[model samples]
Target: MTTPQALVLGIVQALTEFLPVSSSAHLVIMQDYLGFKNPLLLFDVILHAATLGALLVYFRKDIGKIILSLVRLKEKSDEEMLNRKIFYFILVGTIPTLALGLVLNQWIKAMFTSVTFTSLMLLVTGALLWISKRRADSERGIEEMKTTDAFLIGIMQGVAIIPGISRSGATMSTGLLRGIKKELAFRYSFLLSIPAIIGALGLQLREALLEQTLPSHPFPWIGGVLAAAIIGYISLVLFRKIILRKKLHIFAYYCWTIGTISLIIRLAT
Candidate 1:
């Protein structure tokens, strides 16, 4: 890919990755229409790694607390116990996500190539976001979260494996529908993505190694990675603010608008 194309792709990935929008949908649309190509999966892996790094840096403090709590799991304090439970909740959430992803792996991969189908899925995502706005006020915290809630949210995350289905949006909407407080739901959704993103990166890395596809020019790829990481961090911060302000449904209108336009284009072509 050219430097400008790489940079644009990187920005799209970072901006949509953590937002209530599907990064995969945006990437696929760009590739299909703009004819940008990155062989051997190098560009994809780099971008994913960058976003993963962003997540790690943003949640470093929470990760440290979770690790410390695990090390001293025998403690009797309420705070310590709550931390331990949060750690386990993440694990529990990953179980269903991994299971569903594995079973639907090929099916999900197929969806990535179809802009028309992805556009339809984007409509589904928009509907979910709109519905989330109607949920009653919730004040429950991590202390009151149950394994079932995590599992259900995980199922939503798993379903988001399909192209155009926003992973963050689905999981957060499920959490809110389950009556989870907005802040906690927002925090947990991103936290839950850590394992999912890592697993995806590992798989992509293995594919790249097997294909042995190396880029002749590495500078643009490096630039892409930096752009993705920096933009991803900013997107995360902005998403948190939007969720806290109870205005997440604002994204619903964007999704619906894009989905309709995409559908019309697909039909015309």
Candidate 2:
């Protein structure tokens, strides 16, 4: 891929990585429709690592507080409970995706080659979003959730390992339906993202090394990584605001419309 192409894909990866939309779907669609060659899995690693860094940098203060609070001699009941539960929830959410990514990585890639599957998965993603939008208490905060709710949301995060499944949409919807507030749901979804994203990328990176699929004209990753991280950070903030304003149903409509169109295009092609 060209430098310009790499930059554009980096932006897309950053944005879709956080948004309710499916990043894998958009990447596949762009690669197919635009004739963009694969930039190798290494480039993908750089992009995700950059965004991971972005999340770390942007949330550094909150992350520090959370970490410190965990080790402190004394903490409030509610704060302590929420922190402990979220720590476990992150662990639980990472387990299935990491295991599945390692074991089923090839099978998942084969599915990616099938445009029909991508489109179908997008359709499934949209359906999920719409279902939650209709039934979920769009007003609940994550702080209001129970331990079971976190685990249940964790399961949905596991399912998002498939290309078309929307990780944020799935977890947030699960949280919402469980009566967690929108901002709280979004935070959990994104926070859960930290572990899941890193684990999946690491697995994929390992597979790429074994397969020796590294591209020759590798993008240095500095620019693409920075772009993704910067954009990802901004996206995280914007998405939180959007959720707080109770505008996620707009994303519900977006997922449905785009997924439907993509499916139709696949069937027609």
TM-score of each: 0.96, 0.87
Clash pairs detected, candidate 2: 140-180, 140-181, 141-180, 141-181, 142-184
Highest-scoring model, lDDT: 1
lDDT tens digits, residues 1-269, model 1?
78888888899889989999888888877777766543325567778889999999999988888889888868878878877888788999999999999998888766777889988888999999999998737677897888899999999999998989999999999999888999899889989999999998888788777776667888888888899999999999999999988888888998899888998998998
CA shift at 136, candidate 1, in angstroms? 5.6
For candidate 1, the per-residue lDDT at 133 reads 90
What is the model-wide C-alpha lDDT for candidate 1? 0.87
Q: Return the clash pairs for model 1, or none.
A: none
Worst ten-residue run, lDDT, model 2?
135-144
Enumerate clash totals for all models, in the order shown. 0, 5
How accurate locally is residue 134 in candidate 1, as Cα lDDT from 0 to 100?
82
lDDT of 2 by residue, 1-269 (tens): 67776778789889988888887777777667657455255666667787788888877766776687689737777776677667776777666656656666668877766667877787777777777766445554445556677777877887787888888888887788787877678767777788777777777688767755556655645566777888989998898887777666677667667777877887887
Query: How many clashes does the backbone of model 2 have?
Result: 5
Stretches of candidate 1 exceeding 4 Å from the true structure: 37-40
